[model samples]
Target: MLLKELVDTAATVAATRSRLTKVEALADLLRRLPADEIAPAVGFLVGRARQGRVGVGWRQLSSVMGEPADAPTLTVADLDALLDRLLTTAGSGSAALRSTALRDLTSRATADEQDFVGRVLIGEMRTGALEGVLLDAVARAADAPGDAVRRAAMLTGDLGETARLALVDGPDAVAAVGLQVGRPVLPMLASTAADPASALEVTGEASVEWKLDGARIQVHRRGDDVHVYTRSLADITHRVPEVVDVVRSLAVDDVILDGETLSLDEDGAPRPFQDTMSRFGADAPRETLLRPWFFDVLHVDGRDLLDEPLSARLAELERVAAEHRIPGEVTADPAVAERVSREALAAGHEGIVVKGVDAPYAAGRRGKSWVKVKPVHTYDLVVLACEWGSGRRQGWLSNLHLGALDPQGEYGEPGGYVMVGKTFKGLTDELLRWQTEHFQSIETRRTAHVVHVEPTTVVEIALDGVQRSSRYPGGIALRFARVKGYRDDKRPQDADTVGALRALLPGA
Candidate 1:
């Protein structure tokens, strides 16, 4: 199929607010794609390239200046092939070669296609073809059960591959996708609650576990081989040999465990989050030994427990890795839940997560079955732009223009971010210097004082609460907002939404 065809379909999807309309448009488009183009087309619609991070930054992309093709001729496969070439083009002078190739490709694309390609390359495609809507569209196009498609996608951790399987190989092939011992599945997420008592009200007879302020890790072990994946499912096994050793020592031959890992000081207190992430993101493991603490087990031996209740999974978790199990208590009493929360907080952990004892594992879904409570109001928000610093902090990016995701376009474009507030507080000189260099690398455009960037960086912000205001497009601004840190583990799409922020309004 032509790239224009996909671009036009994305436009159609973006022009409407009804999810049904978006799904129908994307389904129609998906039905017409050839087998070879299914994955690439899905990736383009979702604003992710098949070749992740092709070394083409905004600077390189802006360097390409050429006239667009008058007519539609570029195919989806052609664009995918070009991205593949760009991914593999690395060495001295590789930048020049990649730029030349990008120019050649853009020169052949029409104006709309150029814009679409640029957005896709920079991870800014906001056509409302969200993964959830696109998954529904894939099911619609394939005439498969939506639940089955969703389950397959969650199990495989690859929507593009799931789309290809469902569309090309039929629903049976999609159904055949199952939990692999080596591959990583999407980690389950939790909703936020005011406190453990509030969370327990939502989840009766709950397991209140410590909410650690550390990196999320998913460990999959088969025989002696172990793999560690981050929240986004990127493998960091080589960077965390300590975690590998822990997983390998588990009693079970094959298992899938979800937990957190962090560096601890001599006092057994968790190190600063940045310290852990710095070691986590390193190319080689450092002397800081990360200890693993398993909270839930999804698979054991040859049996899959994803469909099992939390009680059952925790039983299995305790049986195999009791020593590594995160501290928690299973109770229906609100007082006990509060005690656990207090204990967790007193121990320097974040707070507690109250999980329903009867709820099955809902991978990639943030439903009310699990709720987290912390004393401070913290949110993961996107950095929309950065202001040039002044005075003593001159020449650095100091103030951050923060935005919350607006999935339904209630205040702006669908799937785009609505600016909530700005903050120059809580940033150390190191962060200011780092962001000054980093933001420019991903900078989309700039003014004399502000540098606008692609909405991609995710930063954790602590706030007193949100107050209604007309100063921003979202009609709510973060009160007393300050940066906790940059969440290198989160993606822009994973940031909290505008609705979530509005839910914090007084009497809400």
Candidate 2:
């Protein structure tokens, strides 16, 4: 199939707000795809490369200043082969080779095709047809049950392959995809709750466990071979040998354990999340080592626990990783939930997760089966700038750039503020209007996407916690930050400080 056809369909998908339209367009595109092209087609539509992060960065892409062809000539297979060469091109003159390859590819593409290619290469499709919508499209095209398709994709952690199997081999083949010992499946996620009592009220008889502020580790063991994957399913087995050794110590011949890993202080308390990420993201040697704390087991000794209830999974977890199991209790009592939450916080952890005892793990989806409770921290932070919103809020200053005062010059100049993050959450149309008008009055400078304003406006922001940041000057950034409301009465200097945020760091 032509790359232009796919790019045109992506534009149509993005132009419509109706999911039904997106699904229909995608399904039509899928029906036209030959079996050999299914994976790359699906990958491109979903804004990912089948080759995966082919050593291309925005800087390299920015260098490809080519005049796009007025006509379409690139094929889907053509782009795929180009990506293959880009990924494999390396050695001394590799930089020049990459530049040449990118230039040639872009020069052959039309303007729209160039935009599509850029978006796919940068990993931001923005077509409104993400994995969820694309999964529906695959199911529609294959005439298969959505659950079967979703389960196959979830278990294999490869939506593109799932699409190929569902289209080429039929429903049974997709259904045949199951939990394997070494291949990482997508980790089940939790929804947020106001408190432990609220969380327990939703889950009933539950397994409440510490929600550590650490990297998620999915440890899979088959015989002596063990692999560790992150929450996003990236294998990081070589980064932490200690975890591999611990899983290898397990007597079970084959198993998959879901847990968190972080480096703790000498007192056995969890260190700041930055310290954990520093070690997790590093490829170099470090003195600090991460320790794993298992909370659930998906497989044990070849028996699949994925379809089993949480109670059963916990039992298997206890049998396999009892010593490393996170501190928790099984109860329906709110008092017990509250106590466990307090205990977790007292232990220098972030929060607690309450799991329904009878609920099976719903891989890759955030269902009501699991709920996480954490104290919300809100601060009157200054708005450094605002970005032009997209979609419904287009032309409005929607995303607020947030900053924290650094009075002591700990992060930057004395008496100035350091940027922590940006968020457009919790904004109503009324708020957007107010910000658009208000920010323009104090606008100091402007860019195509951002309106820089004098840091005089104070807005209240809420977040889950903070993480260590190399991008921000303060060496920290807010996690899950959202705007609460504008604090009209507060001055910029009266806003929260970097020190105040650092105090929220675990074990601080």
Candidate 3:
């Protein structure tokens, strides 16, 4: 199919708020695509490249200028092949070569197609539909159950390939997709509750495990061969050899373990979240070592435990890798849940995750089968600035720039606010209108995208925790932060200090 046809379909999907309409439009587009073109088309429509990050930065894309074609000629396969070539050319003069390639490719696309291609290349193709909606659309187009498509996508770890299978080879082929020993399956996620007792109430009989403040890893092992992936399913086996070695040493010949990994201090306590990230994010190994703690086993001894309940999976995990299992116990009593939560918090860990004993794994989703209970930390922070909104939020100041007071002037002037993070979540339309009108009164300066305001307005912000960072002046960044409400009664001096924010850092 022509690139313009896909681009037009994407526009239609974005224009509709009704999910059914979006699914119909996408399904129609998928039906028109050739079997070989289905995977690339699905990837492109979902704002992803089939080959992952193509090493093409914004600078390279913007550097090459090409005139739009008057007719539709670029096919989905054509662009995919062009990207494949671009990925191969590297080293000296590779930039010029890539630029030429991009120019040649763009010159063949019409104006709308060019816009779509540019957005796809830069990772800016934000339509309402992503993987979830597209997965449903694939099922609709193939006349298959949604669960079948979801399971195939999760097990294979590739929605694009799953789309091709469902559209081309039929439902029987989609059902055939299963766990491979060395390929990571999507990690199951948890929804949040107020506390352990509250979570246990929701899950009935449950296992309360210590929720560590670290990276989530899915390890797949087949004898000596082992592969590790992040929560987002990016392969990081090269960066974490120790993890690979540990998985390889497991008694089971083939197993897929879902767990957490973090660095521990000399005292055996978990290191700061940043310290673990410092090692995990590095291209080369750091002095800090990562220890794996398994909570659930997806596959064991070539038997798939993903369809099995949590209790069965835990039993399998104990028999296989009991030495590496996370601390927890199974109980229906809320009192027991509370005690476990206390133990987890006292150990300097984040909190407890109460999981249903009878619940099977629900991968690629945050379902109610499990609930995470963590203490909420709220602070009164000063408003540093606000940024212009986009799409539905246009004409309103949507994203807030939050800063913590620095009383000691450790990172800035005494009594001045130091930048910490930005958040656009938990804001209502009324709140946006209020911000746009109120912030302008204290405006110190203005830019195309942002309005600098006097750090006088204090707002109540709630965050999960803080992580060490070089991006902020205070050397820490807020995690999962959102506005609770404007603290109109509070002054800038009454705002929380940077030290107070840093104190929330886990294992700090």
Tens digits of lDDT, candidate 3, 105-133: 98898989888887677554555555778
TM-scores of all predicted structures: 0.99, 0.78, 0.77
Pairs that collide, model 2 = none
Reference-based TM-score, model 1: 0.99
lDDT agreement of model 3 with the native = 0.82
lDDT of 2: 0.84
Ranking by TM-score: 1, 2, 3
TM-score of 2: 0.78
lDDT of 3 at 161: 93
The alpha-carbon root-mean-square deviation between model 1 and the true structure, to one decimal in Å, is: 1.0
Q: Look at candidate 1 and tell me the lDDT of residue 496.
A: 98
lDDT of 1 by residue, 347-465 (tens): 89999999999999999999999999999999999999999989989999999999999988899999999999999999999898899999999999999999999899999999989
**Model 2 lDDT at residue 269:** 87
Off by over 4 Å in 2: 377-508
- Cα distance off (Å), candidate 1, residue 398: 0.5
Candidate 1 wrongly placed segments (more than 4 Å)? none
Which ten residues in a row are the worst by lDDT in model 2?
A: 485-494
Q: Model 3, which residues run further than 4 Å from truth?
A: 377-508
Ranking by lDDT: 1, 2, 3
